[model samples]
Target chain A: MKRKFLRRVVSGLLVLSVVAAAFTGCGSASASENSSKDSDSASYRTLDEIKESGTINIGVFSDKSPFGYVDENGDYAGYDVYLAEQIGKDLGVKINYVSTEAANRIEYLQTGKVDIILANFTVTEERAQEVDFANPYMNVALGVVSPENAVVTSLDDLKDDDEVIVISGTTAETYLTKNYPNIKLQKYDAYAEAKTAFENGNGVAWANDNTEVIAFANENPGYKVGIASLGEQDTIAPAVTKGNETLLKWLNEELETLGSQQFFHKDYEETLLDTYGADYEETLVVEGTK
Target chain B: MDFNVINEYIPLYKNALLLTLKIGWQGILVSLFIGLIGSAILYFRIKILKTFIGIYIEIFRNTPLLVQLFFIYFALPKIGIVLSAEVCGTLGLGLLGGAYMIETIRSGLESIPVIQRESAASLGLNEMQSLWHVILPQAISVSVPGLLANVIFLLKETSVFSTISLMDLMFTAKDLIGMYAKTIEALFLLVVFYLIMLLPISILGTILERRMRYGQFGD
Candidate 1:
């Protein structure tokens, strides 16, 4: 009798667990559908709406150094972060830094998680379809970094066994997969992991933004930026959710206004000068859009 | 929501599912081997090896698998112990699952009545023979359910293989979502593929558990 009761209780628990799993699975699917429907109507806070809240959430990469990264003081401090602060000041609102990875930048905007993305976000025609890009703030292109011993000077130099390390969702990954389909690419989700993997010799070389690889080679000894530029030159810009006309317009005007003062140049000198030096200042910094 | 995208992703998902299963089964086999050995050490009350196995269990059980994988893949290479991502994933899953398996099998071993050992000895069996013919069979039968649960658990834990860049199912799903932004379709297919992998094992586990509960196997 006791054994039978035990079996019954066990079966009951299993059934309950199965039902719970089914419910959770359906629940999430429906929830995401609802979110997508809501997004279709444009679920972004406008400029005045952001001011009304007194705080604007700006997504930035806490790991991408010199562009968007946390400083030694635990505060967000970088080229893009400096721009974010100025935008916050101009809008008369506080800035809430939301650390984001490259893969989730569009999702963050579409989900109403951030008012702006300033994490060295490169503007491409494809990305523009999902998020509205503001005027250019910086210039960037893909670059490869490798150890001093076996530097990857060109894509053809990579042999069959040579794997190139790339951070997922970056333009570098897209470019390589498109252009060099035969190259074996080891993709990491985070910048830090890719850097670590590269350092550990997991891959023959690392490909990323020219600014990033150049900065990495400069900062870390025994590494060199061998293919200083791989793809077409692209401009970095702040992004807002699609259909966020008010916020998008405000950002463009603000960037143009800042251009008069050479704000991004100042941002470069203050935040990126240490990593990139004065020689790259003019070439890397874009003072608003043409 | 997007059937077309799901249809498009089936081939990629198929390849990723195979990789996941390959790593999952390899890890399970390693854990089973480790668990049996560790539990046997404790069963026989081996002096130094028992203490070592006990510490191994405690350390692996206490730490998260992600940290372990990171250490093996990234940190260990700093100290001249380099492991590939695939090796690190299999080893991490095996080590973590082995810890739980050791405890599970130990409980089953201890649950064997003392008289069972004595009866085997009285029947002219030596210590090893008694353990081999009597104690282990009963203990393993009692342990089928727990072992199956651990197998399922280790399989689920393969989701973390993406962190080390192993190209598992979760990695494929995340990569698809990242590349296309077809979040709904990617996630829907992810759920379906996981169900395909896990549901059969789950149902089989239930049947095995029922059989063991009624003592049908040993008899």
Candidate 2:
């Protein structure tokens, strides 16, 4: 009996030590990896390296329509996806589309999970410090959509209890939190959830990119874009890993060249024209920073 | 790595932690109540209610909490059953957890020897008395470990409450990360807060489990 007790205690200590060691090992390994990623672009592939690899991973939203969404045919089809295809063609590499969310766009680039982020990513000074933004390709601003029965026309109209639905990590969330602190915000991690919540009357209005809310209103009747432009106009651009100058320069030059050919115009015509019609083409398309 | 950001977010995390604990405790209580009732119904071999509970267990156990939450918060309103996010969160967690708790407690109840029940009945104890005095203590002793595990799981599952927009710990972390891109700081705070919330429960559970074990074996 004494021997059995000692053996049990000894084995228990061994198991506990093993678990502790495993946890510490994981913590240190991840810490080192994150630190290295922050200081340098060693993990990210260079433009030449990407070309040689013959495949480029481009992050795009798989839910936001007219921008980056999977179509009924189950293929990635949208404005950003169209640009990505053109990029793949110019770079002479096959495109590997990684579906990303609004929040993880920077993380995807920093972690070398994708070569570029074209997920309707709005350029902000804070985000630019973390990820290198290429030249602008489109124009965007915050917009709010609400049910026709109770349209939320202005920011001041939202009372304390009236929650405004916004997707996590989008410009809308930031804008509302900063400018209208009194308005309660209901945030969802995904666009689909936000839309569903809005439709279910969980929130009085849904705030998102003007392009997204506009498209949403066009696609789904009984809702209207009550606030077409809520905050400062921002440009949507491709983002690469910070300090990945080779890819960044290549993207800028590509955008500048693509501008001369009106590439974004064609992309808009193909992907966004049905939703926005012809009038929005000039306002929405940036065409290589010009 | 960034102590400043962590310090700045402490108040936010503190609020988030409270909401998380509130929901976690409420959900656990609900699960216990449901688990006890369902197990009793099964132990007595009640016919129709037993079948109904069996189906409930299978449905909640088979489906993910995220889906159930979406159904409760988003889908149900269409059928004229609207619930607030907090209510939906608690209900979803309780329903999902009750399923697992029932299975855990049922196994414990089944582990009690038939002779124990017969012996209680022969000793002038009624059915309720047999269950209350004789069967439950031994069955609960066996169940302590599994129930504790389920408790921990249900607490962790409260992380999903963020999906329904309940401003739980996970939502605060993700919101901070989204707004500021402070990945390391936000996630570090998230880990600390969750540990703060869960570790005490885990320690207390171990103590209770050890005490119960000592009582059962006298070792």
**TM-score: model 1, chain A:** 0.87
Q: Write one digit per residue (lDDT tens) for candidate 1, span A1-290.
A: 45655675576567657755765676576567556744345468988889999999999999988788888999998889999999999999999999999888888997799999998899888788778999998899999999998888999988999999988888998888889999998988889998999888889999999999999999999999999998899999999988788899999999999998998888888998998889999889888775
At residue A111, candidate 2 shows an lDDT of: 76
- Report the lDDT tens digits of candidate 2 across residue range A240-275: 988788899999999999999999899999999999
| Highest DockQ against the true fold, candidate | 2
Q: Score candidate 2 by TM-score against the native.
A: 0.92
TM-score of each: 0.91, 0.92
* Alpha-carbon local distance difference test for all models: 0.87, 0.87
The TM-score of chain B in candidate 1 is: 0.95
List, for all models, the DockQ compared with the true complex.
0.27, 0.34
Q: Each candidate's root-mean-square deviation in Å?
A: 4.1, 3.7
- The sequence of per-residue lDDT tens digits that candidate 1 reaches over residues B1-219 is 556777899999999999999999988988999999999999999999999999999999999888898888989999999888988988999999999999999999999999999999999999999999889878987899899999998999999887787888888888777677776677767877887798778767776776776673442
Q: Report residue A116 deviation for candidate 1 (angstroms).
A: 1.5
